[model samples]
Structure formats: structure tokens, C-alpha cells
Target: MYAQVNATNSNSYIERYKAILLQHPEFTPFSWGSNTIYIDTEYTLYDVDKNGIPELIVKEDRSKYYIYSFNGTDVISSDVCYWSYDECLYEYEGNGIAIHDGGMGNMRIENVSLYSMVNNKLVWSGELMSTEECSSFDELYSFLDSLTPINDFLPITDYSHLSN
Candidate 1:
């Protein structure tokens, strides 16, 4: 189940989340417009790499996400999405990560693309399928599930214990 932070405790929760981020020298607090972004219902902590340490999966909104992981000492982050139209649905598939670009446009699909995390970076595999081609969301997901990882797995300490 997903944990959703309440508005009453959001301030305290942000404070705690900020404190954790401060421990990582490479982490810079993100801001949108004039306000600072904080952990809330949009964030999910999980071991995406299957390593014991949990990675911070921050879903800034329905269309944007950022994944932060501690590579032993320094914290590293990868942009899961930058723009709303090009935003991709990300998931850990098989032994690696898969990003499904559902594409954009009102009348027709523009850019239907799929990406695999090769050495912790997104590598476009090309436009194999389009949102128009899929009959259901399940079919799109199944297609993404078929892709394989390009890099070998890197194991690290589990960070789930620090999720509190």
C-alpha cells in the first residue's frame, strides 16, 4: 500500500525529508515556481534495483518523477521526466528499469518511445509501439515488460530502514 502524508503533518514531514537529503552532499532541494518541493503523497520509497537500500522515488506530479539513489557514499539522481507531454510511466521490469512513453497529441500519437536504463541512464530503444496501437493499459504494460536490461546489476546496501 502507498503512504499518503496528511496536510496537517506536511510541514514536519518536509522537515524530516529535508534533513535526510542534507546528509547527501550531492542532493539539492528541488523547487517549483516559488515554492520548494517536499515529500508527500507523491513520493514512494522502494528498492528499485533490488539492492537492500531503498531509492527515493519522487513523483512531483502525475507527469513528472525523479529517482534518487545512494551509490554507497554520494547520492545520485536521474530525471524520470522533464515535460508533461513526453512524460513516461516508469517501472522496474524483470531485472532492470523500463520507461514507457505513451506519447502525446489530441488527434494522433506523436512520439511513442520506450527506454531502458543502461548503466543507470536512459537509452532510447526506439518507437516499437504507440498508444493508439494498444487496446488497453495492460497491453502497453505487457509490451514494456518484454524489453530486457542492457547493463549488469549493481548491488548496494538497502536504504529501506531510513525510510522512516
Candidate 2:
């Protein structure tokens, strides 16, 4: 299940993604070397940074997400606020900011931060509310629930059409 490319902007990260995906219709953002949660997932391409180029976003049940950005020469990865840890959940604040709520009581905390894809890597632009501040997690999901995700996920099989 591979695509044959004749010509493309080889320097473009988008082309690189197309090459990888068109070559493997079952493309997945992760391939955990050991036992891991690599199943029951979906992906989509979106211009997450408003940079006119689409980035690959992978997620499991829309709870845990992984962002893959291209910085010209390589694919950058950032799962920080996008990922979940047992009880954590993610809510995209649009732009590059990601909101994470996890734990309870003393263990409960809210992580609100802005991130950026820099030089082939994902780096924290800045922490709006540092977890070190021990900001209590909001019990009310009203605001959070009222908001919608950047979600436009699709099966890997539908992704190959991007370059065709």
C-alpha cells in the first residue's frame, strides 16, 4: 500500500509526510518500540500553527493527543499538554496553547501553557499558569465542555489522498 511519487518539493516537510504516508497507508504517528498504547487511534492534517502548512495530529479517543510538526528538515513531536496521564484530559485553547486538567485535591492541578514548534522541536513558548503555582483544577467542566476540540480526526486510510 505505497504511493509512487515522480516529482515533488523534496525540501518541503509536507512532501516528506506524503512520502511516508503514501508509502504506508496504515501510517501512525507513533511506533512504540515496546508495549504501548498504539492502538484504537486516529489522525488528521491541519495547519495547527496558522502557518499555511498542515501538521499531523494523532490522538486516542480524543483524550490523549500527539502533535507532529515539521521544521523544514525534521518532524517535531510534543505530547506535553496534549497527552493524558491516567486522569488527565486535554482541551485545545486554539493557537499553540494546550490546557490539561488532572488529579484531584492536593494532587489536582491545571496546566495552561503555550507552545511552539521551533527548529525541528516542540518547545514551551511560556507557561501561562505554572503547575508549580499549584493552581487547583477546575471542578466545573462547563467552560471546558462548552468548548469544542480542534478535532477533525480520520482513519489513516483516508490520509493518503492529500498528495494524490
Candidate 3:
């Protein structure tokens, strides 16, 4: 299941695909893709670059596969290719894509780096990490607060399980 949030209106909207939550708005499920990929012994959903957008980390036993995306749209693919060899138990690093705005538009990356694409080619952009590196809960909150661009950040609400 996934979650959906529409901020187009003055009053932001949020909804969940399917799932039961305890009693908090934070427990509300978000709309997500129904498609899944099998990797290792467990199905893993990765945010790719820790951004809000996520992609299914399809794992096929011992191999790694990615649900490719282009401009935030999942590419229609049915073939699985050898992305990398396994080095961990159930997690495969460098096996997903992330969208980045390279001072122009959005670009995809397998790994978050200090550099990103430029002019349709990979080039040095800038370090991804800021001075506020995530170290503690307070730091995380501070980093989150530091995000200037409002739309880039998602609203995290704590709502009661009470229905409308």
C-alpha cells in the first residue's frame, strides 16, 4: 500500500491506499504502487535517495533488479537484468534510482552523490550533504526544518484514527 498527498489546495490533503492503523494520523497509510518485486527472501521498498518518492526494490533471489523510472514515471519493463552481486543478507546497495534536480530539471541517480547530471551528461554539481549532517533526532529535525523549498518537503501529520 502507498500514501497520497495533494497540496494543490489551500488545505492539504492526505490519504492511504489500504491498511489499518492504530489511532494516529501518522499511522495513516499512503497510496503506493500495487506492483511488487521479489528480491532476497523479503520484498523491499526503497526511497532510493531518501526522498519522499519511493520505488520497489525488486529482488530475485540472489540477483538485483530495479523498477526503472523516467521523469518520475515507471517504465514499462518486464525483463530483469543482473544489476549487481550480493554482499549483504537482504539489502542490496546501489540497486535503486533517485530523482534529482540538477539546477535545471529532474534527473535519476543510482546513488546519492555530491555530483549529478548536467547537459544530459554526468558532471560535478555539488556535495549532497550540507553542514547539518544527520547525527541525532534533533539534528534530523533541524535538517528537515532547514529545507527552504516548501513543496520539496512532505507534511507529516499526526491524526486520530477517527473517521469522517
TM-scores for every candidate against the unseen true structure: 0.45, 0.54, 0.25
lDDT of 3 by residue, 1-164 (tens): 21222233321211220121111133222233985543322223333333343333333344433231112322222233343333221211343232222122253212222322222122334434332344554553354344332122111222222122
Which residues of candidate 2, in runs, are more than 4 Å off?
A: 1-15, 19-38, 60-66, 71-82, 85-95, 104-106, 129-147, 160-164
Candidate 2: residue 158 Cα off by (Å): 2.4
Candidate no. 3 TM-score: 0.25
Total clashes in model 2, counting residue pairs 3 or more apart in sequence or in different chains? 0
By TM-score rank, best first, the candidates go 2, 1, 3
Question: Tens-digit lDDT track for model 2 on 96-139?
Answer: 53444444577655555556556534566775554456433343
Candidate 2 or 1, higher TM-score = 2
Highest-scoring model, TM-score: 2
Q: Compared with the true structure, what per-residue lDDT tens digits does model 1 show for residues 7-108?
A: 233224333434444433232355788998543324445556666655555554344555565455444566555534323444554334455543445664
Q: What is the C-alpha RMSD of each candidate to the true structure, in Å?
A: 11.8, 6.8, 15.5
**Candidates ranked by lDDT:** 2, 1, 3
Clash count per candidate: 5, 0, 10
lDDT of each: 0.46, 0.51, 0.28
